[model samples]
Target: MVPSSHFNHIRDNTDLKLELKIPELNSQFARNSHNIPPYAQNKPPKPPNLALKISMAAKTTEAPSLSFPRDIFAALSPSPFLLAHLSPQTPSTPSIRPNGRAPSEFRKPTIHRGSLTHCSGSAVVRLGDTAVVCGVRGEILLAADIPNPPSAPPQPAATDASDADADDEDDSAELSQLSLLVPNIELATGSTPTHLPGSPPSTLAQSLTARLRALLLSTRLIRARDLRILHRAPPPPDAAATPDVPPTEEAKAYWTLYIDTLFISLDGNAFDAAWAAVVVALRDTRLPRAWWDDDVEAILCSDVPAEARALRLRGLPVAASFAVFAPGGGVGDSAFRDGQEERAWVLSDPDAFEEALCPEVVTVTVDCTGGERRVRRIEKSGGSTVGRELMKGVVQRAEERWKDWLEVFGVGNS
Candidate 1:
């Protein structure tokens, strides 16, 4: 039932400009951007490890309701849900996961290893309703030098394509770092039972690739200086080597390690699911030692390689998405909820059905890198407005879940 005084959306034909006069509602709609893509030029310059998806929906009630933050590009889409005030019904506390599981019943994940034999390391993981798979593959290439190499050089990793555009001659022979490729494929078939025609790859794959690559470089996980050629430098090779390098300015190594991962299948919680496989596969990686020669213009490697390194990931970014339905009278307080530490119905992960019903979706991405497994990046993604009360609940609960992960990872709780 649409409201009698339905909001007459006023958009500028030239640029799709929206103008709302309601003071309070105006404030809610005043977000910086509608929905910015990951590598958005004006976006915050940070590489995010996890991709969050949020969904929003409006109740059928005519009380004036419309979903805010629509038309998501790639990376994170809002997960949707429905909740009505029907005279304000405080839902009788339901079973923990609404699946009748005890409050402590965490989603059980099925782990499959060697899923992608063609790739370096691969695994298919399923977390109850959500499923995700990751693979790692890389070619030994010369490292790329940043336009302006840091005194501590940056890894010359390429993001766009394998046709990495780089300059190999200007590199110093002392550094040894290999560019790695971590591609993620989000399979449409993994979502529901609707038989997504298993085609020749899809949009999810491309977006995942962009998102993963951006996340890798943005974080500066691996740097070029860290890319040292063991045999290329010592008692032999000159100071000038032209090893084929990737355009990666970030090279990842041990101590503060980096793992190149790819996503294959995606069900729901791809972030958490992929992480499980990533950590395990990384534990399995064994890199080779090789160096560059500046003078002779060559990279050297030990007949029997010496040292191999792998960085211990700060931990994984467990992302959560939830949807809110029929929010804010659709007229009065028509603010959409879209913030990391704000909003409610924040699920560990959401399934497709739930996604369809939401008017506003929220995703919170957290990183638990502490030896004790801490939390980082409480990233919000709905790109909408939700009342302050609901927003608080979302943040509070997300923290709880973060702690739960630590318990499981630290205690080895099966």
Candidate 2:
């Protein structure tokens, strides 16, 4: 609404002031650019020094590299680590396990007999890091005390081979039926991480005990005659003239052996170590001469060491354990596809670390005391990597182990 003349006058004055200040502002900018400090001047950032960067990277590559320790790497990736060792890159380089043992090589066992004095017989066996102690205690069980005693076998006639054989068979049957051999296994706290303190007996312990009992009976390691206490009634005072009447002998009692096994340290292959200790302890046992006392109606064992008799073992049976490790994958996988056969290693006496990586396990018990080898038992589980041919090889290795054990027992290779 203001007058047009006033607006024009104001526009003309603004134009005049801008015209006058334009030159001055240009001059001030030119002078400031010339006098500007070197640090204050805006310059394009220098191209990154490619050569220097390359040198630094080369130096980093050449410097000593950092790596995880062998143990730590193994702990982090056990399966891959074991696979690398077992399956070496170079064919010429020998394949050795991380523990420095070759595949199929067994750990030498160390045995000390009579380690425990209180028990009738005792031994401590060590296989690699695993250690176990076995003690055998004989307790007298009177025939009368048995709830259902087995009927006595008829007396074997002299010069009758058939009757004698029948008697021997009866003895073996009686021993098995009476449950004379009892085995118990105890995995001490701290023996292994799985065995906790103050816990009841584990399934592993119970299974081991049952296996030991079965092995003992199946092998017939101990002779029944050695355990039997016989009592013969003396002929009447005036019966010397009567030669037709013979003294009648009867079995009054039997010695029941209680085999107890304790694992002090368990690395792996627990069954092998336990069974070896049992065999050694039984061999080292010496049972005192026991007899039935008719007057006191009790079983008495002689205190004299001379009267004690050592157990007669049938043969030396040794157990060997093996683990089959397949690096590619588990059983029933397509490892055999594309002409690439499955690669597996049969590790003998696998330790804790190797055992953790392995999926299949085999145990063979053999007796090589005779000229020919005898396979007493074969236990397999977990995988099909071990077939018939592989099992035969396992048996051969078991026989070799048997010989080694015989040497440990001070018996020459027979």
Q: RMSD in angstroms, all models? A: 28.8, 6.1
Model 2 C-alpha lDDT versus the unseen true structure: 0.84
lDDT per residue, candidate 2, 1-414, as tens digits?
899999999999999999999999989978889688766777865766999889889998896867999989888777767878978789998889998999978888999999899999999999988999999999988888888988876332224564345334536677888878989999988999988899889998999898888888877787776788878766679897987865666778889999999999999999999999999999999999987787898888889999998987787888899998886554333433445556888998899888777779998989877677888888888978899898888888888888788878898655
lDDT of each: 0.45, 0.84
Clashes of each: 78, 0
Query: Estimated TM-score per prediction?
Result: 0.50, 0.80
Q: Write the per-residue lDDT of candidate 1 for residues 1-414, one digit (tens) a residue.
A: 876444443224323432334565656655634664557645577644443212122333337755543233111332221332111244575524323344223465566666665654556666675655565553454335334323544444434442233222233222222224344555554454443666665654565456544444433333333343322223224324635533333332222123444443444444545556564454344445545556776555444534654433334555444545343322222344433233334443554434444445565555544434333343444435556786666656556666665554443321
Q: Which candidate is the best by lDDT?
A: 2
Clashing pairs in 2: none
Which segments of candidate 2 are over 4 A away from where they belong?
Answer: 1-66, 154-172, 234-246, 330-341
What does candidate 1 score in Cα RMSD to the true structure? 28.8
